[model samples]
Target: MHRMKEFYLVSDRHIRYAMMKAFFDARMIEGSSVREHGVMMLSLVEKLKDLQADFNKEETYVDVILQSLPPSFDQCIMNYNMNWLEKNLHELINMLV
Candidate 1:
């Protein structure tokens, strides 16, 4: 039973790591391409948190999301307030979605 639990734990960690890598490595898809992927990735992130995954900080995740945005978002990025950016990342994500 203990070994089975350990195996499950390792498997969960591996899955979480894979998802995180995929999200970070991904570029912004053209049009609405990233919306679905973003939603799925965000869901996976929330799920991994439930499993006690040592996820990256939300600020870093926000930065990654911002960077993944297309050139059209450059204006918004330039206008972004770093403090508000950290606090209102969901708003930014919603805009993209």
Candidate 2:
């Protein structure tokens, strides 16, 4: 019998590129699309996985996304701490919707 381990290759450049792209795309979210946008952004941020040292990056990303929303979202933003570490992205997405 033989045992084998599998490994996958990932490029730093690709990861960085993806992160930036997702960040920019999330920033572009607005109005009625906030739900779908939040979902996508959440997925993108989660994809960072081991590439990110801590949740700070995700926190900043969510903060920017919230700031980019229209005035209607002001109350939610004000009521919540916007601390990604304290809140789950799925909950944020639900609130946005």
Candidate 3:
């Protein structure tokens, strides 16, 4: 566990991820294997870098406001998700009849 924490202390994100992978590969932790980590862990690094880039911006009111807006903001007409149930119970009843 000490070594795991030491590896995570490194500034390089990729190295941290690799160390995490090694820890999981050795079957050290339960309910969480490296295969289940997926791209989300790496995405955390990317999100941090993006925030850093946004922080680096040093400027006055230039004629442009560079901001990130949701891609489906105004274009979205519906926010609900449908499962479209197949009516399995009804099918079973029809078969009995």
Candidate 4:
């Protein structure tokens, strides 16, 4: 039973690592709408939550989405930072779209 528990913990850790990697590596492809990208990112967040991963939804996820945007969004990103804007994922997606 102890070995089984250890194996499960290790498996869970591996799954969490893979999910975190995917979340960080996510990038908005050209021609994709901001809404689609945001939704996909949000989905990954939800999955991570289910796995009990520790993450700051307000900042980390938002930053990840912003960083994932292509160069075409540089102006928008600058404006957001310049204005000290605080927007949730859904709100940011709406603004970008």
Candidate 5:
């Protein structure tokens, strides 16, 4: 039983790590709209949540989404940083769209 528990824990950790990597490495394709990209990121976040990953929804998740944006959005990213804007996932998506 103890070994079984250990195996499950390890499995969960691996799964969590893969999910986190996917979230961080996600990028907006050239043809994709901001809304589509944002939704994909949000879906990854939800999967991480289901795995009980320890992350701040408002900070880590939002930052990952922003950073995953393409170079075309550099100006938007700059504006958000320069103004110190605090936006949630949905709000950020709407703004980008």
Candidate 6:
């Protein structure tokens, strides 16, 4: 049996900006140690950069549909919260497991 991983190449600044805005707007109690705000910001920024890359590149870094700017779990867990890492930590771990 084999499993495949999904990839996405989001090319919209609006989506990226929305995600950032939502995050800042969300006011949730969070655990400081478990979550690293800097890393998450970096990852999202990198995603935005990738989205801004040439649409007609010889070798594309991205190779899948851009669902959400930065894809999230199913609907049940969608929200704009600064403590995204803590809130969605389990969801992410579940994906790996």
RMSD in Å for all candidates: 4.5, 6.6, 18.2, 4.6, 4.6, 14.8
Show pairs that collide, candidate 3: none
The estimated TM-scores of all candidates read 0.63, 0.58, 0.21, 0.82, 0.82, 0.27
Error of 3 at 46 (Å): 0.3
Q: Which ten contiguous residues of candidate 1 have the minimum total lDDT?
A: 81-90
Q: Cα miss at 18, model 4 (Å)? A: 1.1
lDDT of 2 by residue, 1-97 (tens): 0111113354665665667676655553345677777776776666555455235555676676676677777777877764433556677678777
- In angstroms, what RMSD does candidate 6 have relative to the true structure? 14.8
C-alpha displacement of 96 in model 5, angstroms? Answer: 1.0
> Worst 10-residue stretch by lDDT in candidate 6?
58-67
Encode model 4's per-residue lDDT on 1-97: one tens digit a residue.
Answer: 2364477766767777888899999999988887888888888887788778967557787888899999999999999989999997788888889
The alpha-carbon lDDT assigned to residue 33 of candidate 3 equals 33
lDDT of 1 by residue, 1-97 (tens): 2364487765766666766776677666657565675676566556556656644677666677777777877777776743354444456567666
Runs with alpha carbons beyond 4 Å of true place in candidate 5: 1-10
CA lDDT scores, all candidates in order: 0.64, 0.62, 0.30, 0.83, 0.83, 0.35
Pairs in clash, predicted candidate 6:
none
Per residue, candidate 3 scores C-alpha lDDT tens digits across 21-92 of 442333212344323332333343344344342223222100011111123321221221132323232231
The weakest ten consecutive residues by lDDT in model 3 span: 60-69
**Model 1 TM-score (2 dp):** 0.63
lDDT per residue for candidate 6 within 1-97, as digits (tens), equals 0111123344355555655554334332233321343345335445545545333541121111112223332242343223343323334424322
C-alpha lDDT of residue 85 in model 1: 48
